[model samples]
Target: MTLPAVPPISFQDIATELRLLPGEGLSFSWDNVKRLLGMSRLHPGPISLSDFLGKTRPWWGLVPVRSNDIVGTTWYSWNQSDGGLAAAVDPYFGNMPITAIMSTVSASGSDSIINFQSDPGFRNNIKAQLLDDNYNVVREVVLTYNAQAGVQWRSATLGGGDTSTCLFIATGIFTINLIKL
Candidate 1:
């Protein structure tokens, strides 16, 4: 089955560019959390998943922030009992696409690994997996996001080919850095 072109990893929203804290903190914020929360209220009634995901605001605003970090997913749950802060990321990205082009001959050998960028405490069992165009899980490799050694490596091989592209999805709030390897 052909999936719709996965909407460009939404990075903008309806919020005016004028700084919410105008004249200060002048930086492009990546805040999908705040944008998705108000989905139902904005669209109302029934809507297709694609339609909802496709909604583009004049611009999106930041989710609640704390100590200078974007916080909480619109759907997942977490906790910060002291100040009661919680965060989750889009599950859609969990199923983000990967392609053969994401492979490097180095990671293809037994001694090398795929590099998945991560911080020390945020990830557990972080990984990289190969998928076919149909989204079937073809192969998976558990990544060790070792910040101490500055290494984020996972071992997985999808043989060799180049006629098509698949996904090299990571296990967290994925950043878009599609490149041929």
Candidate 2:
């Protein structure tokens, strides 16, 4: 079946509405969490499958440091609980439609791991996926990342054609629910 097209929205825009703390504490307001998940009211924390079906928010997101720059590779890895991940993509295509599933993982004094998984077929030759809280595919991109051994910022590629352009965010034991609807 063909899906309707809806433009992508930024997490910051959603975060601003939800009043989420920025790089500080981990307290998320109940009401904002509901809105972030696109729920009418807040359900139990760590939303369940029932909640997932009712929501429309992206399943995953990556917090942009500056307007154009995404955070960092280390942050994108599942090792850092506080770190984040944007959907992987090919740079050749300016924009590709997607629905994503995402999660963050970090233990005390440990690296963060941001896991993202999705099919490239849905978006038509897309490279990677972005996720929402319920592990849903929210965004797709045509970009890839190349991380040197000790680099801070990752060099993003335009497409998934180059193996050297790809980087994997280590999948640590970050708890996330990614369900393709």
Candidate 3:
């Protein structure tokens, strides 16, 4: 005899494995949310006024823009036209954490490559770092903004172990994107 068909599991049910509920927001104190996404809570940063404030909420969005469309301490507009980053504001000032639903694997994972970006002509020394759930430094790299260099992005690789058991956190100025390839 054939067995009956199975219904697809709901998002809430799936969250249970991560110890989450249907309406739970990710936190720097939890694992499930961090595991599912590479979101990390940033420390408070300094407050400043700049043109970056007008930027949209999502890093990659382009429509119906509003200042309140804000996403945390960072002014990340969902839309983006330049590759500088999704958020234009200096996240360091807010001392806030950058959070995202990160990707992962059970074992034998590739390296975690982080990319940093900035204006081509600004002279600055940016301190950037990547961390794991235990708050361990996985990798660290600095991005120098020298209009001459036009080095919009500086990338460094870290961690090749199984990601199934840890959460990776990205911190610093510019945009912090974690990727494994």
The best candidate by TM-score is 1
Model 3 is weakest, by summed lDDT over 10 consecutive residues, at: 55-64
- Model 2 residue 121 CA deviation in Å: 3.0
Write one digit per residue (lDDT tens) for candidate 1, span 10-35: 22222222223333342222233223
Instruction: Assess each prediction's global lDDT (C-alpha) against the native.
Output: 0.28, 0.33, 0.30
Per-prediction TM-score to the true structure, in the order listed: 0.26, 0.20, 0.24
**Residue-level lDDT tens digits of model 3 in 45-161:** 232222122221112111222122122221212223333333433223231222221222222332221123333233344443345443334544443333443533232222454
Off by over 4 Å in 2: 1-55, 61-76, 79-120, 124-181
Model 3, residue 75: distance off in Å is 27
Q: Where does candidate 3 stray beyond 4 Å? A: 1-88, 91-122, 149-181
Off by over 4 Å in 1: 1-121, 156-181
Give the Cα error of residue 102 in candidate 2, in Å. 12
How good is model 2 by TM-score? 0.20
Ranking by lDDT: 2, 3, 1
- Clashes counted in candidate 2 amount to 42
- RMSD in Å for all candidates: 17.0, 15.9, 20.3
Q: Clashes per prediction?
A: 14, 42, 34
Model 3 residue 174 distance off true place after TM-score fit, in angstroms: 15
